[model samples]
Each structure stands twice: as structure tokens, then as C-alpha cells.
Target: MKRAYGLGTRSVAVLLLSVSLAGCGLPRSGPSKSEILAGSVEKLGTTYIVPVDARVARAASKSPELGFSADFVTADVVGSDVIHPGDTLSLVIWENVDDGLLASKGVNATELQELQVDDAGFIFVPYAGRIRASGNTPETLRQAITDKLKEQTPDPQVLVSRAAGDGATVSVLGNTGAQGVFPIERPTRTLSSMLARAGGIAVDPETAQITVTRRGRTGSVWLKDLYRNPRMDIALRGGDVILVEKDTRTFTALGATGGQTRVDFDSPNMTAIEAIAKVGGLNTNLADPKGVFIMRDETPEIASAVLGQAGLRETQRVAYVLDLTQPDGIFNARDFIIRDGDTIYVTEAPYVQWQKTLSVLTGTASSANAITNAAGG
Candidate 1:
């Protein structure tokens, strides 16, 4: 009975130990409020500004409401429906059914005219010598022509149209399959429609930026906003060029991360914790959970500037090391935003690296031996 009781006590003790060990392996509860607040203060004490391209700045400088004015209309002419360059005409009697006036061939519906109005914003027509076309449309210009023709030709019937060359075109460049001049047919042409005509954005998702330039006025619009924000899709004008560029910059995150290898969040503003989640989350067995190092190009100049702003001593460097094991550490992860050229490194427990190295070596040796045997055979 004594022997049996002693054995039973040992078994119970072993069972309790096993249960305690199993509980330890389970995930810890999330951090508390005080912990998160402290982390936020430590991680995001200052604002970070990323450098934007010069073209981007120039593009934003112009007024959003640009080029919605006159001076974009065609000429007004009688029988000379077509507006052409260097065409002289004779304005004569119309009521005298016997006047030596001949009907001029009207301009075609498709001819694009490049008519230039004088300082008075008027085009010189045949019978309607000089009439304003800058702020008027074809139908409106026709009425003005009819009024003027009445002076020379009695009740002269004047037909007005685009007259000849009126349409203007602009170019679309960069990251597009088709790069060429796009004609401005309508008065208000949108940016989205233009991009669609140029064979849509790239299949592989990337950061997209568009630069618009017209009459020395320029602006840049983010590609994301072109779809998300309705207001960003502004009307385009003639002589405006659009250049769309892809987002190529990326940072790498490695070790015990959500993903074991490289994870491309694609933005410099990605936080350390966000990057980890993107990869897959921490590997329980291997992750140290405390030492998270964000290795960056901490040049002396940049380091000094950050340090000066941070009010840190010379001994301290800009490269930051964060601990996520402490309960409050999770909050710091949220506040810590990544920069353009940063490498996030999550260290592992001491045994983790050795185990990984051994696994890799074993696999390599096995492959090598198999290849050697195959060659001999």
C-alpha cells in the first residue's frame, strides 16, 4: 500500500508540472492601457516628413480650378463654313437676288482649326469681317456673323462651325503601354478617362503618381486618390501632359515575423507591428519577443539631426531598438512608424538560430549527397 501511494503521489506531481508548462506555452493576454500610452509616447514623439519629388510640388502649386475660360473657340464665317488660314473673301449684296455673291463651301465637320483671334478676341471672317469667337460657341458665333453680314449682304445666311483647326492635344508619358498625344475633343476632359485611354495602370499593384502640366502651370495627383477621392479627378486641358510613375520603394522585415522571409508593405510609413502582422505574426518558439531592432542608414548627419531634435546625448544613436515582450511594448509597436530605407529585425531566442542553421545544413548536405550518388551511378 505504501509503495502504491508513493507512486501515485509522484504521478500527480508530474501531471501538475505538465499542466503548468502547457499554460506557459499559451499566448499572453493583450497589453493594458497604461502600457500602451507609455509606448505611444516613446515611439511617436516627433513627426516624420518624407521628401516628395520636385515635380510633385510644382504640380500642386497651380490653382485646382485652372483653364475653365474663354479663348478656346473657333472663327465665324459665311458660306465659308470651314475656318482656314489665309482665306480671303468678298462680302456683297444678298437681298438684290442679282448680286455677284457666290456661296462659299462650308467647312467640314471633322477639320481641326488652329485659328488665332486678334487682341480683340475676334476672327476675321469673309462677309463678317471681324467678329468675337473667343467667349462664344459655334451657334453663338453664327448669330454674330449673321448680324454682321446684314450690314453688307441683305439678310445674309451665314453657317458657322469649328471653321478648321480648333482641337488641341497633350501627351501622356511614363509606365504606360501607350505614350502619345491625346487630343482634347471635349471641353472638360477628366484625368481618369485619360488614364483609361492610355491602357490603364500596371497589372502588378504599385504606387502611382501623376504629374499634370499646362501653360507653365503644373500639379501632381496621387494615383490612390484618383479612384478613392472623387475631387482629385480634375478636368484636363490642352497642352497638359500627364506622367504616371510607380511606387518602387520598399522595406524588408525578417525573423519570427508573420512571414519568415521578406514582406513588402510597400510604404515607408508602415509600422513595425503592422509589418510583422503582414508577414504572419511572431513565431512563438523562436521569437525573443523583446528585442526588435530597426536597422537603418543612420548616417552621422542624419543621426545628429534626429538626436538634436530628440534632445539625446551624443552616445545615443538614431538606430532604434524596441522591446515588445513587456506588456506595454505592444503600444510602442503601433507608434513606431517605419522610414523609407529601414530594415526591421526581430531577434529570436538563443536556440532558434542554431536550430535553423542545423536544419539548413542538413538539407543542403542531403541534397549534395543525393546529387553525388546520382552522378556516380
Candidate 2:
């Protein structure tokens, strides 16, 4: 009887120990507030935490300009119909003399259908050896050719016109109606006009991202912004590459929200409340309305503006907290804007942890009673 009693007590002790150990490793939606503040130090590319308020929301609301600069917007459009190398010129040469240098049988004029301008910007004629036609306009090239032929054939008249040729053009690619090279004509000289000529953006205009690359530099703007801001309708240059694509900016939803996902921007701008709705709102059964958090790496300028303190480090780590339980919490959230790459987190209710502990303890007690009975039997 003494041995049996001892076995029962030992079993009870072991059962209690097991329950305590399991409680330590209880499964959770995410880290608690205290855990985030303590363990997040020097971890997961985050190092600082800051609570958000109305003032911080206003100061940090200013987003970076994502459109054309003064240099691009203020630039004057290039001359229309500028000649370039490898252009095709059609010329009709006429002479008063019946049997002229460029005339045909019983005709006072002759036609040259395709005169391909060489890589060296020179075109060869019947009598005029070779004349540069690259940089000259139709009128100037006609005058130059007339001068060349008038020396041999008296009083020559020439008419010059451009045909389909490899001239000033831009390449439109990626998520556009027509992905090909389009010449920069009078109708398609600006960024907006060129996009229209290419059948506009294939993706939704609200989430469309247009990138223009000229020379070696690149600039980008949202399609909505391009139409809203006239300054963003920059001039297109020769050999510029325009890429229309869907917006890739997204924010991560984690913790006790309805779902955890990396959601793309569906509109030009998204507020914090909209972001919450986007992730299917919080899990009311498990969420702490006061523990909502948004984490991001802010620029030094924005960080100073938000904290009203200068001389901060480059890209300061920040955490904006929102308490939906407050009368004005929802309003503050509505005012707060969600920037790119922000990670939103919601903490679980404190009582949820207590419930897990009690559950483990109840199971342990039942197991202990069974062990005691077995020992006695």
C-alpha cells in the first residue's frame, strides 16, 4: 500500500511538470506586445518601436514624389520631322530641258521611290555623287540636291519627302496593348500620347505603374498620377524605353488578423483602416483592439518629421500602434496612410493565454487521477 501511494504521488508530480512545460511552449498567433519589444531588439531588420498618434500620422503622411522632375516636365519638345540616319527619302527631280540629267524618255521629271540614307548620313543620286540627308529636313535636303544637280543639268527642281524609315522612336513593352517600337510623331511626342498610341495600359489604371527610361536614367509614375498631374506628362525622347506594368508594392498582414498575406495595392493610395479591411479585418475572437501595430523602416527626413526630432539615423525603424477601442482610434486609423512594405500586426487578447494555461492544467489533473488509480490497482 505504501509503494502504491508513492507511485501515485510521483505520477501526479510528473503530470504537473509536463503540464507546466507544455504551457511554456503554447502555440500562439504571434509574439505578444512585451515579447515584441524585448525580443525584437536587434532582430528581424527592426530595432526601434514608436507609438503612433494624430500628429505622427499627419507628419508621416507625406509620400515621396513618384513622378517626373522639373527637368523632364519643363523640357521643350524636339523639332518635328527631324531627319536621322537610315531614313528613306522619296524625291521627284524635274528639269526644263526635255533631255535632262534626271528626266526619262519624253518626260520632264523623274521619280526615285526609295533612296535609303546610308549609315554615314549620305544618299547617292544619279548625277549628284553623294549628299548628307541625315540632319537636313525635307526642304533643306531638296535645296542641297538641287544645288548639286544644277551644276551639270541647268535649272533643276527637286521635291523631297520622308517615307517609312528607322528614325526617332520609342519602344513600348510589358503590360501594354502593343509592345513594339513606335515612331515619335507629332501625335505621339509626349509620354501620355505615346501610351495612347500604344493602346494605353493593359492593367487597371489605378494600379498601373509606368516607368520611362531615357539615356541611362529612369523615372516612374502611377498611370493615374500621369493624367491627374499635367507636369508628369513628360516629353518622349529618341530611343526611350517605356514599360507599363502592374504595381508591385505590397504590405504584409500578420498576427491575429483574419488572414496573413502580402496584399498588393489596389488603389492609388490606401489608408490603415482600408488595409485592415483588405486582410479581412481582425479576428474579433482573439484580437486585442489596443495592440494593433504597423512596422516599417522610415527615411531620416520622415522620421524627423514624425518625431519632431532631428539628427536621426538613416532609415529609422518605427512602429505605429492603434487602439480601435478608443473613440477616435478608428478616425486616426482612417487618417493614417499605408506606405509600401509596411508590416501590420495585431496581438492576441491577454485572456487567451490564460485560457491555454487553464486548458493544459485541466488535462494534467485528469491524467494524474488516472495514473493514481492505475498505481493503486
Instruction: Give lDDT tens digits, candidate 1, residues 1-377.
Output: 66655555555555455445542343332222233334432567332222112332222112222221222211111121332222222222233234423443342112114446544556766545677665565567667867876677556665444522332456889877688776544422677777887887763333566777767756665576667666667665546788877655566776556554555445424666777777777778766676565655544344445434454433322335566766657666666666555666666665654565555555545555555455445
What is the number of residue pairs that collide in model 1?
19
Estimate, for each residue in 1-377, the C-alpha lDDT of model 2 and write its tens digit: 89988988897787778776864688898888767777453566465666667887887767876887666778777654677887777889999897877777689999998899989989998889899888888889899999999999888899997763676788999998889998888788899999999987899988999998887788999998999988899987778899999988899999999999999989878999999999999998888988998988889999888867788778887888888888889988998999999999999988888888788878887888888887777
- Candidate with maximal lDDT: 2
Error of 2 at 276 (Å): 1.9
Q: Report residue 180 deviation for candidate 1 (angstroms).
A: 3.0
RMSD, each candidate, Å? 14.5, 3.3
lDDT of 2: 0.85
| Model 2 weakest 10-residue run by lDDT | 39-48
Task: Evaluate model 2: give its TM-score.
Answer: 0.86
For TM-score, the strongest prediction is 2
Q: Give me candidate 1's TM-score against the actual structure.
A: 0.51
TM-score of each: 0.51, 0.86
